[model samples]
Each structure stands twice: as structure tokens, then as C-alpha cells.
Target: MEKSVFEYSHYRSYLRMRLESAGRRGSKAQIATEMGVQATYVSQVLQENAHLSLEQAEAANVFLNHTSQESHFFLLLVQKDRAGTKSLRDYFQTQLDEILKTRMVLTERLGKSTQLDEKDRSWYYSSWIPSAIHIATTIPTLRTVGDLAKAMQLSSEKVMETLERLENIGLVRKEGLQFLPGEQQIRIGKDSHYILKHHTNWRLQAMQSLEHENLKELHYSAVVSLSAKDVDKIKDLLLESLKANVEIIKDSKEEELYCLTMDFFSLLKAQK
Candidate 1:
């Protein structure tokens, strides 16, 4: 007669169901005290108008004495529900499905491996070299090493060496005097060290742009205080914007290669 925790998609729903089942023997105020939150807060959370913080969710799981899998599933549901964007929610849901499908511990599976190998990952997170090679393939006039060098503003020797590395990595194929991009898509995991390096390189480039008088370049910054919850929402919005920009680039018939970076971080720490 009772719904299993796995049957619920939203953490709030699961918590509400859980509380209802326990309410026959326990009072709402008692449960609220156990969760270290007010009874009205519990009511609001069950009504789907409020969310539980990470610590609160963890406390709830501990109080409920969930099994390892059930706890993992519940935490994932909380994350998905609290996610600031639909894409992130969908991604977490997909991960949940995979966990159910494989019947393995989520932490064990996630700890096993990265999405990319070392070499391709290195090329992916490198500076403009890989982008220059890929973009050059789209332009017929920029096939030769010298052409790529001139277009990328790098020395011919450096361009040739980079092309050779790209070719070795199977990202580009050599056809007589021209280099062609191979049928490969570049994907890097968010946790990769290469991503940090990549971001650092581009941020340096952005910083350098301030010294140049290029009318085509744009840079913007803002310093504003916001709640922790609002910060999460803004991050999701930024990610969606980035995805939209990628889609626009994909749809363009003739595209020029450009780097777009968005950054948001707290400049000051919260006072205790």
C-alpha cells in the first residue's frame, strides 16, 4: 500500500511519503525536531514550495536509516530537484537510470574511470592549436602548414609540429600537402585536470585582450552579493546560455572559430 522510495522522482515527494507513513505513530513536530527543522518548514517542503539544503538532506537520510543504495538514490533525487536547470536535472536523472540499470554502487562506478584518455584529453584542453586545426579543415584555403600558421598567427615550424601531433592523435589526417580533420568529437569530463588548465589558458587570453584596442572584442564583469540558492540558479542559467551558443555555432553554415568563456566566483568569503 506504500510507495517505495525508488518510485518517487522528486526528493520532496519521497520525504512527504516517508513522513506520511511514519505519521501514524509519530507527530510532525517530533519528526521536525529529529530533522533539526521547524514543523512549518517540513510542511512547506512537502508542499513543494521549499527545498532542503544538502546538510538537511543528509540528515534526513541518516534519520531515516536508509540503506546505502536508497541513501544514494535519495541524495541524487535531492540534487536533481534542486538543480537550477533542466539540462542538469536531466543529466542527473540519466545517471540515476544508469545506476538502476547496472545495479552497481554509484560511487564505485563513478570512481572507475574518466570519459577521456590522456592524449586526446591533453589535445582537447590545449590552447588554440586544436581549434585552429579543426577550423582550418572547414576552410579549403587553409589546408597547408604555412596557411594554418598564417591563419593562427603561429610560426610555420610550430604549426607543423602541432599538425604532426594532431595527426598522431588521429584527430587530423594528412592528405598529401593538406591536413583534414578526422571523424572525432571532442568531449571532456567536468572533473578533468585538463579542464582547469584549459580555463586558465583562455582566462589569460581574455585578460590580455584588455591591453589590446580590438573593437571586435568584448569583456564584462560584475560584483554583486547574492544568496547561495540564487548563485546556484545563476550557474544553471549560464550553462544553458553556453549550450545555446554551442547550438548556434553548430547550425551556422560558415563559422569563424572563437572562444567564449563565462566565469562566476565569489570574491569574498562568508564571515562566520
Candidate 2:
């Protein structure tokens, strides 16, 4: 008995096995012809020297006659393999396994419950408090109002107020004299109002950072015209990149807190 198609982690290997099982074995040229690509390109992909583009992958999926679920799995395998960073590969691989095991559509799973309560929502949207609390968690010496205020370059009164709010919200717990981060997931629903305010505040802060003379942070901007289809692809890539960064940060051994923010939007309407 052979392994199922879903068991193969590598898309190239899966394609090879799929082709062989379909009685189209030992001929790269045939596969290339089906995919409308050159024989050498197919050879490179099979040899792990190259990868399939999104278009190529979709074409191959069609050629293989994969069902919707199998096609999705194949695309995820390609995404996992083509990921530029290890963190991204790991994240997508995890997602692939979960989807296969649970027999759940990725989009449907993503749309399910992962929301913060009102208190947590309010606590996270305020921004500086969460940052301060995270920093304090890593640096025990920066636990008190005066210490945190001086470290964060804010007034003691403001830090005190934020700390009290965080405590009331159950995001921080007092262990002896030091504050520790609560074991909580800070997830917000897609339609949450806090999402808008959170993004607005960060975008404003990002713009403000440009005016500071001694700023050492990185800021980049680009404007380009793209098809709506390509825009959707870009959005998916951005989301995957964000998730990858979160995974990387979560696995870090040292505590150097930093906020990662990204903003992408259309600046012009498509011409009819």
C-alpha cells in the first residue's frame, strides 16, 4: 500500500508520485507538455532545483485532476516549500498538517472564533500599555510605575494608570513586586471596531516617526498599479508574512520587544 497524496510534504514529490500513479511515469516531457512548460523546467522542478509559480501550480493541479481539497493542499505545499524564511515554511507546514488532519477548509477554519473580550480589546487597542507590560515582563527591574515610566520615557502617573487598567483587565498579574504577562491570546475578530482604531493609531504613529530627527527605524513605501487578481495575491502574501513574523517572534529565546506593523491599501480606483 502507498501513502495518500496528502501525506507527501513536498509538492514536487507529490506531483511525481501523482503522475506515476496516473500511469504517466518516466516521461518528464509528457508532464511538461501537460503543464505547457519546457521539459527542462519540469526536470528542474522534479529535481528540487526550481519551483512552480502560482499559475504553474494551478495548471498542474488541473492536469492532475485534483479535487478542491486536494488542490488546496497542493497549493499549501507549494507555499510552504517556496517560503523565503524558515519561520514561514514552519507556519505553513503546520497549517497544512492541521487542515489535513481536521479535514477542514483553511478559509473556514480561519473564519472561526478567535476573538478578544471587551476588556482585552480595550487593553490592547490603547497600545502603549501592552508594550509597557511586555517590556516589564522581560525586565523585572522595570516593574514599578516610576521604573516603567522612566524606561518608557512617560510620566509616572500615566504609567500607573495604565498598569492599574492592565491589572483590572487581567492581562498582567502581580507576582511578589514584579508584574508578569498573563497567559492569554491577544486575538481580535475581523469585524471588531478595535481593529480599525488600532490600525489608525499605529498608522498615525508610523507617520509621526518620520518627523523624529534621531529615528533609526526602517520605513518603506511603494506605489504600483496592479490587477485586482494580483492585488488579492499580494494581500495573501502580506498576511502569510505577518503570520511568519509572529511565529518567529514567539520562538525567540531572548526578550527584546518590538512591534511589527504593516499597511497596504489601494490609493487609486481601477479605470473602467
Candidate 3:
């Protein structure tokens, strides 16, 4: 797969990706034309002895069909590569980092809409508020900041701030004065550092929700001692249940949004 431009600190590496990127018909000749150099010169540049000048770097961005933010990032990559000293590279790195923090480039061709860098990921997973606001947009009645604040029991200022941050990372979108869910989807994996925090945020909210005397709210926790063979069996059943529920959830109406968290794990140490 062709990696995102922001994933590379070196413009040459990104150009190399552009050269060999699957399904995108490009060649050294075409790339050389874009960079205004001979095909041999394109080879030399990729080999690291030669480097792209600022203007040629812009040309490369054009050749690679970069978005505006991606073009900026590509230019910064070239600048960082041309830096003579560590301090200079570090300086450009800061610019690159800032861009990564705020921009979520859309790789429409790749069909991967969301690529959250570390900073933006941190901001999004920092609290439940941003996530809540993201989900609130999917509700028809909660389109405006005022409506979101009233529905979510948050301040308008807080809603706007979170909405801006979410929009920056492509988690939310605003059309006119109405907010809507962005095309992006956040997927937190088991090994992610944010997984604990992601779970904690909602679990805490789930705890607080217990105060509400509503039959719709559900909570369950159990620690069981079972035969070793049945342990895997129980886990398989839980996994099956989750998969079945997910299928049902997919076709359900978007009337309300909710988080469904499930945890099943060993409470005791292994019998080693």
C-alpha cells in the first residue's frame, strides 16, 4: 500500500513510494518530467545522493497528486531532508509535527479515510467529551452546537472546541451551521495504548449512568472459576454473541447512539 506522505520524514522515501506504488501507473520518466530532471537523475535522487529543490519538490507534490495539506507536508519533508544540521532538521520536524497534529489527509483512492497521527489520536482519546460530540452528530435532532450542548449536558463553548478538534481529525463535519458525522471511523485495537483510556472513559460514564433509574441501562460483571476446557468454550460463546450483536447493530436505525463495551478475561494468574 502507498503510505501517507506524513508517514515519511524524507521526501525521497515518499517519492520512492510514489514510484512503485501499486495500481498507480507512474514511471521514472513521468516523475522525471514532473521534477524537471532526467530519468537517470530521478534514480540518483531516490538513491539519496541527489535531492529535490524547493520548486521541484512542489512539482513532485503535483505529480504525486497531493492534497494542499499533503503538499505542505511534502515540502516540509524536503526541507527537513535538506537541513544541514540536526537543529535545522529538528526545526522542520516541529513544522511537520504541527501539520500532522491538525491535518487528516484523505486518501480517497486508497479508501482509508482516517489515519490518526499520535498527537491527534491523543487529543481524540483524551476524554469522552470529544467522542460524545462525535456520536451526537449522528442524531438528527442534535445538529447545532446549541442542540448538542443541550442534549449532551455540555457548554456551547466546550462543544465548539471539541467539535473543532474532531473536525480537524476528520471525526466530524459541519455544513452551514449543522454538524454531521465525518466519513472517518476510529478503530482502537487491543494493543493500543489508548485502549485502556478508551475503555476507562466509557466505563466511568457507565458507572455514573447507574444513578439513572432506567430499565434500559444495563451492567454486568462476574468472575467465575470454571473447568479449564470450559474456559475457552465460554470465551467462544461471548465472542459469538458480540459478532451476532454487531450484525444486528449494523442494520439498526440511527435513532440513538450508544457504546457497548464487553470485557472477559482471566482474573487469576496462570497455573504455570
Clashes of each: 0, 0, 0
Q: Which candidate should be chosen as best, given lDDT against the real structure?
A: 3
TM-score of each: 0.51, 0.49, 0.57
lDDT of 3 by residue, 1-272 (tens): 34677678788887887786665565788978977789888889989998888988888766665545667888889999899999999999999988876553443421464567788889889989888888879888887878988888888778877886776677876553466788877878989999999999988988888787377768887777899899899889999999999999888877776778888777776853
- Give model 2 RMSD, 1 decimal: 24.4
Query: Model 1: how far is 216 from its true place, Å?
Result: 2.9
lDDT of 2 by residue, 1-272 (tens): 44545778899887676555555665667667777899889878988899999888988765664545567888999999999999999999998888776744532433453444665678678774565465466655666656677766787657656664554454554542345565444666669778887777667767876786255577889989888999999999999999998898777764444556887888766843
Which whole-number lDDT from 0 to 100 does residue 92 have in model 2? Answer: 94
What stretches of model 2 exceed 4 Å from their correct place?
A: 1-120, 123-141, 213-216, 269-272
TM-score of 1: 0.51
After superposition, which runs of candidate 1 have C-alpha atoms over 4 Å from their true positions?
A: 1-116, 123-127, 270-272
Q: In candidate 1, how many Å is residue 34 off?
A: 85
Question: Total clashes, candidate 3?
Answer: 0
